[model samples]
Target chain A: MNPNRQKVLDATLQLLAQSGLSGAGLNDVIALSGASRGSLYHFFPDGKQQWVAEALQIYAEAFAEGCENAISKAPTVSQGIANVFLFAAKMMKARDFRSGCPVGAVVLDLDCDSEPMRVLCLSIMAQWQHRLAAHLTPLPEAKALALAKMIIACFEGAFMLARLERSTAPLTLAAEQMATLLEAQLATVSRSH
Target chain B: MNPNRQKVLDATLQLLAQSGLSGAGLNDVIALSGASRGSLYHFFPDGKQQWVAEALQIYAEAFAEGCENAISKAPTVSQGIANVFLFAAKMMKARDFRSGCPVGAVVLDLDCDSEPMRVLCLSIMAQWQHRLAAHLTPLPEAKALALAKMIIACFEGAFMLARLERSTAPLTLAAEQMATLLEAQLATVSRSH
Candidate 1:
């Protein structure tokens, strides 16, 4: 049961990264995961929506962890943001530009009226923003939050542009802008001292 | 006949803004447009893909025109970018946050394997970037293009974040960042002169 659940989640993420939520049919999910109808029904009685929530949750947690890890490990906050986007860019190129933000694909493709899914996507994105914000040391709380929101928006938007044009420039260019902003903020902190 | 064609395009854009490419089924298109099966095929002989292409073209051209109009009317390039986002923010809020970038929604939700669709999206985005770049009066060629691309990516990405979180903060924040960058660039150009 554990293996089946994990497999389903992983497959769902993969499918989402490639095509989107509505494009990811249930039959494809079951087929890709190799989970039987009986097991799927038993595990996900609420059906695909339940499975999707689980998958999104797992990915969202991992994304937050990644942000924390990236920030902690980097020498500077700007580099930290750059590292995250560069990693995403590399993954996208490796996938031949077929990959994108799973959260975004779901947000765009799913019915907008579905509050549960929207809330879930929003929370996941908020988790990422908060993780980034926590690392913007020396900046005011408001500034850090604003920068974090902009960074996430730019990077996620950059992913869409990158995948659309099949180029890494959009992501890398946004990262450069982010690094410059961080440097400017750091310089401000230094002047006060 | 002309009204029917216009209605179809309007409906297509509406649906794309709401649910994305795959989610906008043929029946929905027919049902929403109030156009008969005969008219849809008459207006779009190659079916939905062809219809999508037309809708996208109409959007892309209008998007480029908007950039031109915004930049030409604004007091400065930074203000131009801000005007675009502010207008978008108003529309998104008006739509209860259900509205999104039709190009972006399609890009994320559609199969990346579709070369035609990807090209269409890329072209549309490139047009916007180029339009912005052309207005960077004092900035050098390379810098102008880079700045324009980054601005476009950030603004476009901000829309996704805005819709997901159902707030205008991300869009407004990104626009603020763009304005700052533009101011900085202009200052640099002044110093050099």
Candidate 2:
């Protein structure tokens, strides 16, 4: 991405994180990025929709990278799941709870009508699920897939609740609960094997 | 609630559930309720903010009632917890993924500085936690409280993920996982006692 374009998308992400899709405006993005209107037009001539779509894509990549890192680097899948939750919690807190998963917020805003945006959101979620499933491949595929989906749901839901409640307890509890759930699943798999 | 006022709030809730707070305009509410502009103003003189607050309150009450019914009617605390998830899943599917918990959508659109809205959102969540805890009183108080928070978090998070992914699988999986988690906790409590 061009530095100027990247700057525009990054600013839009911050604005979207704070104000949501409808809350964010082109003027705000221009102001936040300190980029010229000409530059914004040069990059996204189609305007807000285009800018937002690109920003969502950027966030999707970053989020997927985080999941990849967690699974690849953590000593255990349970620890990796915990790390992912911690990372999300920290990001949300750092953004003062204004930032949630872009995929989640966008999906809520854009329905099937916006085919491109819908595809972007679904692709991100599917990729995240795939990554999580990969980590759980040692277990039964069905159980692992189900568990991965549940874990993702818990994390997403916790982010919204924790953000809405303006407290970290929900996220913290979710992490602890998830760790326990994953541990039990691992135990069951071990015993069966 | 006056019949007209109830009509207005119910319409607002329907609109909010379908399109979110920003997406639901006063005109939309009027159209949905089939109420004249004068009547809408007569009911909600302050326009969207006042209307949204009342709509949110109505949603909160209905949500609490749902929780209460689930808990009180179920055979056991574990079953109660599962009932809550099952009910939520049904509601989500019924809405075709358009409606999530009302508080979740409101909190997303509310300005963080809007103290009244923030309080209302917090109160609803606290009420949910309280209801869940009440059901689990037979267990250890701390454990009950912790589990309550975790369950609420999971439900809210699961709703978001399910809606975003436009799939009921996440919701179903989350409910099953939560039942497993709750059953395990209950067993531990039983063992300890």
TM-score of each: 0.95, 0.94
Best by DockQ: 1
DockQ of each: 0.76, 0.59
lDDT of 2 by residue, B67-181 (tens): 8888788887777777777878788788787667666766666555677877888888888888778887668888788888888878876777777766787778887888889
Give interface RMSD for all predictions: 1.3, 1.9
TM-score of chain A of 2: 0.90
lDDT of 1 by residue, B126-172 (tens): 88887788888688888888888888888778888888877888888
User: What are the per-residue Cα lDDT tens digits for candidate 1 across A58-174?
Assistant: 888888887778877998878888888887888889988878888888988866668888888888888888778888878888988888888888888888888888888888887
Q: Which stretches in model 2 have alpha-carbon errors above 4 Å?
A: none
Per-residue accuracy of model 2 over A1-193 as CA lDDT, tens digit each: 6899889988888777665676557888889899998999998999888999888888878877878898689898888888888877887778777666655666565533676766767777778787788889778888888888888878877877777777777788888889988989899878887
Worst 10 residues of 2 chain A by lDDT: A103-112
Which parts of model 1 are misplaced by more than 4 Å? Answer: none
